[model samples]
Target chain A: MTTHDLEYDNPNAIEAHNMSVYYGSFRAVKDVSLAIEKNRITALIGPSGCGKSTVLRSFNRMNDLVPSARVEGQVLFHGENIYAPGVDPVNVRRRIGMVFQKPNPFPKSIYENVIYGPRINGWKLSRREMDELVERSLRGAALWDEVKDKLNQNGLSLSGGQQQRLCIARALAVEPEVILMDEPCSALDPISTLKIEELMFELRQHYTIIIVTHNMQQASRASDYTAFFLMDSDRTGQLVEYGSTSQIFQNPKDERTEQYISGQFG
Target chain B: MAVTELRRQPSLLRAAFERFIQVLLVFAAAISILTTAGIVFSLVFETIAFFSEVSIVEFLTETEWTPLFSIKKYGIWPLVTATVLTSAIAMMVAVPLGLIAAIFLSEFASDNIRRTVKPLLEILAGIPTVVYGYFALTTITPFLKNFIPTLSIFNSLSAGLVMGVMLIPFVASLSEDALSAVPNSLREAAYGLGSTRFEVAVRVITPAAISGIVASIVLAFSRAIGETMIVAIAAGQNPRLTFDPTVPVMTMTSYIVQVSLGDTPYGSLSYYTLYAVGFTLFIFTFILNIFSYWMVRKFREVYD
Candidate 1:
């Protein structure tokens, strides 16, 4: 696909335009627009119930799994609106993979877990090619050294941190251009959290990563760009500020953003 | 001195009431255990008397089962084989039908459809077994005869098929429960990886819920083995060693029912044979229950 929009020199990985998400009649996320750049780590930071995760889910159309959830406006990926008629959510999810807050690995062997994405997409790879793919994916997630000896063990047998990385590897196997993470390190310990932050730095060279985090230090430490969200008077979440991480953290743009970042109130 | 003064003594009336309730609860629990023990005692006693009259070797080895006739061959294989054959046929009908229905209910059916249809499906189980017997004899047998012209009027095929219909609720409801008990995280994980609903259900949910599914099947098999009225009314009382579903056969439960019709004299070898057959049926069901328990314990996956 040719780049039609000139908003960024690097070409935006994903852009949301007047996107609003509703659960039945209750609006969860108000119209909020943001452009995520290619090959950068963008952290969405806010208190609980800010709809940051909601926007993250909308990026890959993960919210479609919920029976009551509905989307309006547009979530543009490679200049194509994902929510357009005849655009299948299944194909959208394949092109933009996700990792959840909690580590979720299939109840299968580690080898099988890595290959599951490719297998479901109907890849016809031989045994040797399959092994190579597993190794490459695991190494990309920086989990190969610890889990390579036990590829046949169940993925659930791994530690919580390892499982999250395994999920990342599983996402990487399908070769997606963008990866969405919803509080991926919230359940992890500080050490595991640090490892994930370091891995994000390593992965930023190849894949565009958008993360929703509740941890302030993590957003400041790990992300190149930061978007701050807060609940409106009606409790519908709206984006308050979006800028470079240094600017959003240190400089004042909005009084609410300053109050939220400096710990005056959530 | 301060501690002793601050302490309050327990009330005797409330303590006595609590003791009474505990005793009542223990008695209620013991009643069920005592009843099972009582049944085992009688079956064993009568079975011992039966073995005294007929040698264990003859009971195990001989092919025919005619304790009432003058020639009187006291073999058990005919009844055993008949029971196994009918149960196998019933499984053939029930397993696929029940599992497919379970998959649809758990994975495909909308909530409204599931809520409305599950009770209707369970109503099949609520139908009395005697009614199923009559339906097999009056309806299914005549229906099958049109296709298999040589089909017997009193055949195991009709009885087994009707019994399988009676058993669908047991398998479907339990299997559905197992499938639904799988965590939503697993489903989300699969869908996020780009799996279709079919792939998510078959490859992930089914395998994850396999232990419970196997347990359900085993329990349903045990229930089918112990079912009597359908086999007695439709499958006939001809005890013969055969696997042929088109022929007349008798299960162990049906044999027990046959003797309990009150024609045989009390304390006769033929009368004692009822308890022996009941004991055999009890053993089969008991083994199945233990196997199901072991299967669940061995393969159950705990999701967090």
Candidate 2:
């Protein structure tokens, strides 16, 4: 799969062209080719050890932090290969933000946590503009009403649900065009998970979202499209199926996808 | 029941051996405790004898400390001021240099480089302090004299600077451990938000591990206060309450060392001052350890 293949009337926010990731000599994810549509939620679903999270991390070049991890193919954003020579991973990550499975808000005040991304990215704003950015970001993440009274409080002081929302607000403050969430709701309660799902629906009007999750119900409920992955005999994760959520859930073409969706085996 | 039969058939010899091992461990632990208690008791006993002759008010308020001379005046301020001055100079050199090395080791160094360099860096701490004292006297003092002609042969400047080099490994190793203990999730979060490695390190990781970093600093400062050989050998035995690093002055530890090695008769006033100075050093280090513990408990960021 090449960038030209996906450059049609509807543009993709990001596309991975036969991307394979290796940790030292061990291949973790093998030849994953997918086009992430703009302004829609795409869920990467698989069992544990299938490297769905690894694939998601590679999209923003977060795997570059791991000294041994290496990417072999191209990740294209806005028709340019992000892995091309001289393409700075810092700038790549600036346009593509990420949220983790754990709500890792910095050990700072809630307002500081929201502004951290912008601050590091060197967005020089006036005090009032900073305040407005914080308010807007919090509102975008559906957390302003709960935390507006105590923006000075430490981010870790919030409940697990509120902390996850604060992380989302922090990610949103960067004004990223794409957000990669690696099981962002896996650590939250069901109510918090529902809030995140609804927030995803609202965010689909603006930014593209690619999420990796083990929850089959969540993939069906929250995402418009779903990509299912499975580990091969060599224990490398490969995409088994990719389609609209309804097609993947109701009438999966691959027998393995059906087996996985029906919980026969993972 | 089978459970009752198994309990009834339990091996008495193995149980006896387990109890014996437990008793041996208890004795081993008790020996160290008893040794510490004995030392503290002797220090307190002699310190009391010394204070009976010299009033605590005079010991503290008097500026001159010349217990060895014929016209003896007992003042602890001179030794205390010299100790503080040397330790302050040592900290000024150690803190920035050690912290930068720690950040490099923890945040920037590759796995191969860090593994190869960290142990080599730790070897600096393993070198004998007596050697460091001589290095300060012979090498650093002469080298520094080329730049600052006012430097004395036995100046606190060289002694404190060499002590700082000796303390670098202590600060760097402990601080690296603290910085490395910060969960990778925080680093990932920072980098995910477009932060460069330097920004992530200085902003997120350092602040997260600040309690441990501060505890390392406190422990390093405590070591500096209790340091004996470096100051005793390179810093001269002149008990002058001066802040000038270029001048020769005696610290509390050095004064105690001087009295211990010299022909100060047993049970004399000068001999008893050894216990007083030792007690002071003990108290200073103990307070710093307690403060480090408190800071660790109070400011630690508990990440789940």
Which candidate gets the maximum DockQ versus the true structure? 2
In Å, residue A63's CA in model 2 sits off its true spot by 1.4
Q: What digit string (tens of lDDT, one per residue) describes model 1 on residues B99-192?
A: 9999999999999999988999899889999999999999999999999999899999999999888888889999999999999888888888
lDDT of 2 by residue, A186-258 (tens): 9999999999999999988989999999899999999999999999999999999999999999999999999
DockQ measured for candidate 1: 0.79
Off by more than 4 A, model 1: A1-10, B1-6
Q: Which lDDT tens digits does candidate 2 get at residues B263-282?
A: 99998888899999899889
- The candidate maximizing lDDT is 2
Candidate 1 lDDT over A125-154, as tens digits, reads: 999999999999999999999999999999
Give interface RMSD (Å), model 2.
0.5
Q: Kindly report which residue stretches of model 2 are placed more than 4 angstroms away from their true locations once superposed.
A: A1-10, B9-15
DockQ versus reference, model 2: 0.88
Number of the predicted model whose TM-score against the real structure is largest: 1
